[model samples]
Target: MEAYCSMKAQEVRKLIREQVITGQTSGMATGFTQANLVILKQEHALDFLLFCQRNPKSCPLLDVTEPGSYRPAKLAEGADIRSELPSYRIYRDGVLAEEVNDITDYWEDDMVGFLIGCSFTFEAPLLAGGIPIRHIEENRNVPMYKTNIACTKSGIFEGPTVVSMRPMKAQDAIRAIQITTRFPDVHGAPIHLGDPSLIGIDDVSAPDFGDAVTINEGEIPVFWACGVTPQAVAMQSKPSIMITHSPGCMFISDRKDSELSVL
Candidate 1:
């Protein structure tokens, strides 16, 4: 993993494409942006794009590949969306049908791949800001939950907003908010802090997705809009076919964290 982190985004992607590194991409390719992936048929693309636009915090649009094209022209040159991510989840009629390391077998000529900004892209800045990221410290993927909060519906896409959690001291949480707010493309500032239950998260120790980490004394749970929301919405809407990077397995991009930062 150390070796991979030092490599450039394209190199990390090549390894993923060749099945050399099949694991969560949480801390990989350090300074580059990592994106959440969603692939839907061309017919569903416009509606999905509108859904993303309606819910920017959770589904920040990073890049969208043309129909049937796996390459994300703006995010990463020479990257293959179908094979670059470590894992993928295939949903049929809104239910997860299978999980695979590669989607080459399922690619369709009319499919449009959407690359949504992921919170991992902002962690480097948070770390630099002196804010502790529990998940990365624990060597685990950030915890995520499906919230009771509903997202605005667009065409056939609609579902509860999802959030990723990271527990931190109040001061650190505040600093994290200030730091993350600068990278709006990557989920941005926390949507909620202190109480997990208020956002419909019943248990802080047990996450719906990714591994749970300790919330230590004097620390509060911070929640951010998650890229997972799109996939959850797709499940509820029951798209005839939908594919997404399995939770925590992200598509690392060539774009730098500095490039996406506003200030």
Candidate 2:
């Protein structure tokens, strides 16, 4: 993992494309910006863009591709969105139909890919601030749960928000909020901390997506709006089709994390 942590974004993407890295991208290509992918037909692009606009906390825009183009010119030039991520999820009529390592076969000329800001992009800064990220330490995907918080409606896209969790001591969580607030492009700061029940999460031990980690005796679970919210929206909006990165398996971009920092 240390070897992967030191790799350049392009190198990490190469390995992912070649099926060398087939898991969550939490600690890989450290310091580079990571993004969540959502691909849809041109007809649905406008509505989805509005959806993102209305729900910036959960779907902050990073780089969006032109119709029929797979390369995200602003994020990772020349990189193929169809196969760059370690895993891809295909939704048919809002239901997850399949999971694959490559989406080349499903690509359409009218497809537009939206790369949303990922919380993983801010994880490095959190670690640098001495805030230990439990998922990275436990070598597991960050736990994500559907929240009662409803997103603003945008066309057919409307659903409860989803959030990623990281258990931290009170002091570390405070520092995390301070550090992450500098990167709003990514889901910045903790939306909720302490009790999971307040956010409609009935069980912290079993998450809606990803793996749960240890929430030590003195630590509280901190939650941040997650890029995975789109998946939940997809289930409700029932789009004809949607393609997204599997939860926690993100696209590693060439952009540096500092590039998105406001401070």
Candidate 3:
């Protein structure tokens, strides 16, 4: 894990493309930015772009690929979006059809890929600030849940907002808010803190996506809008087809985390 944390983004991406690394990417490629992927046909691209524009917090744009091009020019150079990510989820008519290590078979000439900012980009700063990320400590994926809070609809895109949670003490939570606020592209700041029930989470121990972690006494759960929100939207919107990174498995980009930070 330590070796992976110190590796360059391109090295990590190479391993992933070869299917050597096929799991969550939380602590890998420490200082680089990571992104969530969303692929749709050219016809649906405009509507989805509008969807992302309206829900900036959950779907902040990182770099979008040109139609028929698998390369994310702005985020990664000489990297193929079709296979660079560890894992992918294929959706057909809004229903998840299959999970694959590569999407080359599904790629279309008119397909447009959208790279959304991922919260993993901000985890390094949180750790540097002395905040212990329980999921990282436990070697598990960060827990994510679907909230009752509805996202602003754009075209056929409409669904409940999704969020990822981290447990920390009150002081650490406050510090995290300040540190993360600098990176709005990466789902900056906690949208909700304390009780999960307030956000329609029935049980914090059972998350809608990813793995659950220990929440110590006196520690509160901090919720941040998640890039996975698009997955939920895909289910609701029922597009003809969509492809995305599986929950927690992200595309490691050449861009540095600091590049996305406002500070």
TM-score of 1: 0.96
Report the candidate with higher lDDT, 1 versus 2: 2
Provide the clashing-pair count of each candidate structure.
0, 0, 0
Clashing pairs in 1: none
Question: What TM-score does candidate 2 reach?
Answer: 0.95
Which scores better on TM-score, 2 or 3?
Answer: 3
Top-TM-score structure, candidate number = 1
- lDDT string, candidate 2, 1-263, tens digits: 77999999999999999999988887788889899999999999999999999999999999999889999999989999999999999999999999999999999999999999998788888888888888888878889999999999888899999999999999998899999999999988778999899989999999989898999999989999999999899999999999999887899999999999999
Q: Give the alpha carbon lDDT tens digit for every residue of 1-263 in model 1.
A: 77887888888888999999888886788898899999999999999999999999999999999888999999987789989999999999999999999999999999999999988878888888888888888988889899999999999999999999999999998899898999899898999998788989888888887889988998989999999998889879999999999988899999998999998
lDDT of 1 at 21: 85
User: How many backbone clashes are present in model 2?
Assistant: 0
Candidate 2: what lDDT? 0.92
Relative to the true structure, candidate 3 reaches a TM of: 0.96
Q: Which lDDT tens digits does candidate 3 get at residues 120-215? A: 888888898899999989988889999999999988999999999999999999999999999989888789999899989999999999899999
Estimated TM-score for each candidate: 0.96, 0.95, 0.96
Question: Which residue runs does candidate 3 get wrong by more than 4 Å?
Answer: none
Name the candidate, 1 or 2, with the larger TM-score value: 1
